[model samples]
Target: MTEEQLDKLRLDGTKVRVVRDALELNDVVGFVVAWDDENVLIRRPNRRVVKLKRSYAIVPASEPRPDVLTEN
Candidate 1:
């Protein structure tokens, strides 16, 4: 994604599915907390934080749930 897209996601508190490696099926579902040119920090439902390279494929998931929308 472009920096603008990432910035939008970060600002909107949108949930994303991050695909680290398609071959290995490594991915995470969470909302981006912060991002720089090199990396992004995501917080999962369990309150666990994951740091991912900016090159990873990060896409929007389903629409935010009502509770999630209210919480943010």
Candidate 2:
């Protein structure tokens, strides 16, 4: 994402769901804390901060949860 996009997410203080399919990892639901060109820092509900690559997909948490996610 560009700096503008990241700034928007950061400014809104929105909760987001990040998916890392390439790594076969579980989704992370959290708030955007900070970001740079290559990495985004997110703070999870448990207050743990995680650094993720910008290549991963990040979606707004306000959207309806996908059926597949709930079924799991």
Candidate 3:
């Protein structure tokens, strides 16, 4: 994704999952922390930071789940 798009996600505090390949094990679920011309930084649920190259990163088309869920 472009820097602008990524920035929107970051600003909105959207949750995203990054998939590098078909393997489920390689998928990462987190929020976009920041991004530059080179890499995108994400913070996982465990508080671990991950950096992924912009060229290799793929953001899914689904809407992100809210940080907190509620039942009507």
Task: Give stretches of model 3 more than 4 Å off.
Answer: 60-72
Model 2 misplaced regions, further than 4 Å:
22-25, 64-72
Estimate the TM-score of every prediction: 0.73, 0.77, 0.76
- Write one digit per residue (lDDT tens) for candidate 2, span 12-52: 88898887653324778899899888999999999999999
Predicted structure with the largest TM-score when compared to the true one: 2
For candidate 1, what is the total of clashing residue pairs? Answer: 0
Q: How much is the lDDT of residue 53 in candidate 1?
A: 92
Where does candidate 2 have its weakest 10-residue lDDT segment? 63-72
User: What C-alpha lDDT, on a 0 to 100 scale, does residue 41 get in candidate 3?
Assistant: 87
lDDT of 2: 0.80
- 14-38, model 1: which lDDT tens digit per residue? 9888866534246688898888889
Candidate 1 deviant stretches above 4 angstroms: 23-25, 63-72
Top candidate when judged by lDDT against the true structure: 2
Using lDDT, rank the candidates from best to worst.
Answer: 2, 1, 3
lDDT, candidates in the order shown? 0.76, 0.80, 0.73
Sum up the clashes in candidate 3.
Answer: 0
What does each candidate score in C-alpha RMSD?
9.4, 4.9, 8.9
